[model samples]
Target: MHHDLVDGVPVIWTETPGPLEATLMFGCGLKDETFRTLGVTHLVEHLAMSTLPRLHFDHNASVSLSITDFTCTGRPEQVVDFLARVCAALTALPLERIEQEAGVLAAEGSGVADPVTAELLSIRYGTQGLGLASFNGPGADRIPLDAVRETVARHFHAGNAVLALTGPPPEGLRLPLPPGPRTARAPHPAPRTTRSSWHRADVPGPGLLLSCSLDDQAMLLAAHVLSQRLTDTARHQLGLSYDVDGTAVFVGPGRGERSIQLDVREGQEQRVAELLWHEAVRLATEEPTEAELADEREAAREFLTDPRTADLEVAERAADLLFGETHLDGETKLALQAEVTPAQVREAFAAAMETALLLVPCGVERLTLGRPDGSALPAGGCSERTALPVGSQYRPPLLARARSGAARKVRLVVNADGAWWQDEEGLIHGFPFTEVVGVEVQEGGRMLQGLGNCFVPVASELFAGLGRAIATIDAAVPEALCYPASALRATG
Candidate 1:
């Protein structure tokens, strides 16, 4: 079921029955100002999530060259409460606060300064307004907070917002929608059209980045075919790892670009570069084998058919909607991929090999070929420590002591006041209680928190028995318990 509320900021609510999960997605078309607002909005979102109560999870946000989104997931029943809190936060968030807004913008600028790829991107798209290094450049440090806040306040008005909901809908959840159909600003036009080409710049080393630009709509299908064919050929035929991947960027209406990058290891630069060029030329000249084309088609079909693969599709669809591009549906995307001939693939590749090429090599002291320095920053840095708090730990209790086949359940009270856990699945689930100690845990990251109560249930009969025994002992002597604490802690 889906419901739309029409009033101010456009909002839509969707409901489905399954596991209790909720996602709030906000979309705004990308612009220099939009990106600036997104940086501030992102920080504001963090502040809201950090301050909200009964929040099982924190919100996550992403900003792209085209759009920005902020999303959060939680229990279905908490949807209304969460939405209310979010709406309140958005409404009350101070855009006039220069210090806070400038801080976020400065941090955003610092993050992009040293990325060589980003520098290359800036150079490639430099002529386009899209090439601006950031929404706010490094000069953001000089922007007064009040001016930044005023800019944010103006940019965040109803005309530029869309609120979308997914998952089982809560009862009587209310949302504010736009007054009517909202029109978005048209995306910047592509530099040129229908010209197939490739160009390369020699870097000081043997690394290579190959990029090809096409119309966004057509490139979507082309990318699917190219990705699948390259992966299969590289891994099975050439004995290479599947880790070689490329990036696809939506440039504008009839234009997008895709690039395949590889870092040549020591002594293999020439061979690898020659092989890559030959492959590109061959792909442009010859048709893929029928069996190979069929396999790629199957991969494309599976990709469109699978829900897990739908995230990128959903994001693209939203982007297209915002940009006024073709309304590409799943069926249309799949049909296009299925019908794409090997000749078309060759033609696309042939054209792409001509436009622009970038090769970069790092770590080597010298090269026979005279190439410009492409290494932007120092090649190595310290690994980021996990966010888990220092000295905190966790240990799963032994469960083999009870009868192996017996069915039992035990509840655990997680006292993770300021700690977090990385489940086996690698998700960083958090618990904010300072001293919660009684809770039931279900499978996965699901748990219930009561007043001074948080429960995790264990179902392995033996483990359940052990937990039960521990619960009893702890009940009798509460301070004698010893166990590994949570691993997540805040760090500077």
Candidate 2:
């Protein structure tokens, strides 16, 4: 591989025989967006691509959790033309067409990760940063014009981008993005939960997420082995599932979230969910055979040594430079994986699972998972208390209480410097007003999103006589932390 610079943008390149494959990467994506401006990154990407003249080439662009890329495979001149047009579009975005592009974006739907995996991120990181992956963010049209300009100024610039090519830089290639210094990203919010547990979501099947070092070779290989085991048992052996998808997204330097999601056959959701947990725990406590480990190593060898993957390797290097990740060449990475023993894989997977989450679909009931200590994995969500704290409390309006006994049991407390609610489920949810990151302003009341994915609703319909609590919140929180709910948001 070789490295150079094109008009101030870092260029990482390599030799390959196929039509030149080029990818221009920027160091920002969904992780950089706010709930109010959730689809802004996609909007920026779309706005750029929309300006490109019709071309007969396999070119496309995408936004992921932490980065975005514009890629194409074509003749050298086509590569040059594509990158130039993309850069020019960014430098002079056609904001007049934002409404047109917003419609396209909403129709395109979410594809960054599968449904189960995306929701798990939200369950782990609240409603911002990586957690934004699960939300549509009001709507694309709601993304402010100022936000677009700021994103371009902050991200799509020479200092924040890298150009990776399957072949050497094409003749006359140029990157004319705006001039700006590389921006540093704040670390993502701390995880909402860090122990063995389970949660339910709208999904086809179940998934397991493990937080670990990005370069943990053993756990990486172990996750691969578990995927194989699940595929073998669930797909081929029991016929309970049709496919198992896996994803590994880096969240910080030397840290990432790895997951395996399986698709359940009809009437088999519960069985598939149980199978996922059983396979994960089984692999953690029992090491895979030497033969099984060899299969994964050989697969790695094929992938790393393939000439067709040269462009991918280069793109990965670009991400490394952008994110400050420790870059290991193909051979070095393989060498590290080769030294990992079965016992090492077992121990690593076991330790990682101690801080893992099992996500099952919402309709599947009676599903149970246990910690290594044999106790049931606690249900995961915002609730940390079974009862409300003593405070000046509010309750449902008389009409609601008279109509529904469950409403009678609900209590909304707003004293002791914060507000909380004990729902009919009898679980308390909320944070101190100071810890509240965002208070989504609704017509009837405010919905607060804060620590541990807690969203407490102080609304007129649910709890009456909240004027004092609302006033207390207004006095305590920064004015900047409050915003009206998105126009496209579902009626609360």
Candidate 3:
């Protein structure tokens, strides 16, 4: 490996047998934006990539949960030209082209991560930071101009970026990004809700999320082994599911979530969910066979021994530098992972299962997924308050309320204090005026998203005569807390 400084940007590279490939990476992604300004990072990436002239070489850029990378593969001159254009674009973005690029982004769609993984993050953290993944936020078109400029100033700079290459820097390569301080996330968003629980969402299958130290190799191996067990039983045996997917996402310097989700056949949701839970429990209790450990270790060996991964290694080192994480070579990681004994795996998984959040698909009849201790896994909720505060009460649309008793019982209250909704089942989703984050200014109404993963839809579509309620909310909340409904987002 070799290192160099190109116009104040740190560059890490290694010679490899291929067309030269280089990635200019910045330590900013979805986790950096507020709920109202979600997609700003992606917008910035699109705007930068849009400025490049047509080229015959293979080149592109992407923004993930933790880093944004602009990459190209061709002659070294192509590499130098691409990096130069990207850095120049970042220092002086073409603001006039935002509208056109936002449309392009909207057409690109919102499938950044697996839907199941995104939902789990939201449940783990609230609707900000990593939680922003699950939400569409204000959509690409609604992202404020000030948010874009602020994001660029705060994150897109020489101090916050690293460049990785498959070979030494090409002559004349220069990264001329503006200078700024390095950025790290505020101490990890405190886990919003208690875990070792379960919930239902509009997902295609069931999945499990466990919070653990990022360095827990035993837990990591257990996750892999458990995934293999599910694939074996769910697909090879019962034929209840097809693919069982797993991923680990970084949330802080030394912590993160490792999750596994499976896609089930219609009518098999309940069975598949039960299998995931039971298999995870089995690993938590019983030690796995020697064969299982050997299988996973051998798989790791096959991947790590390949020569093609030289470019990935360089990029990973760059990300480690960007995030202030300790970077272990592949050999060191493999040795540590291999030393994780079966007993250690059981103990690690058992401890982690206590922090697990099981996700079952929507539309399945309510399931009583029990924990390893035989307790009913509790459901995730926005609030625990039972009673609505004293305030003016608004009922559902008069005609609809008149037709159904349940709709008649629906109550929404907004006053000087705040707003809350009591559903037919009597569960209250409350949002205090002071604790409110952002309010989507919908047509003829406002929707309040608050702390504690709660929201109140004060819209006329659900309740009639909302003019007074809307005025009360607008007068009570800060003007900066509201934005027009996202142009590309269909619902609140």
Candidate whose lDDT is highest: 3
**lDDT tens digits, residues 115-189, model 2?**
887888888887778877777655776677888999989999998998888888989999988878887778877
Order of quality (TM-score): 3, 2, 1
RMSD of each: 20.2, 2.5, 1.8
- Compute each candidate's TM-score over C-alphas: 0.57, 0.92, 0.96
C-alpha local distance difference test of each model: 0.43, 0.85, 0.87
* lDDT: the better of candidates 1 and 3: 3
Clash tally for model 1? 41
Q: How many backbone clashes can be found in candidate 2?
A: 0
The 10-residue segment with the lowest total lDDT in model 2 = 483-492
Off by over 4 Å in 3: 488-492
lDDT (tens digit, per residue) of candidate 3 on 1-492: 788888788899998998999999999898888777888999999999999999999999998888899999999888888998999999899999999998888888865579998888888887878777777766688888999999999999998999999998988898989877777558867888656878788899999999887678788789989999999999999999889999888988778889999999999998899889999988988999889999998887788778898888899888888888898878987999878899999999988899998888986667776777778888877777788889888988879888888987789998889999998888899978987878999888888888656789898878888988999999988887788876665554
Model 1 gets an lDDT of: 0.43
- Candidate 1 Cα RMSD (Å): 20.2
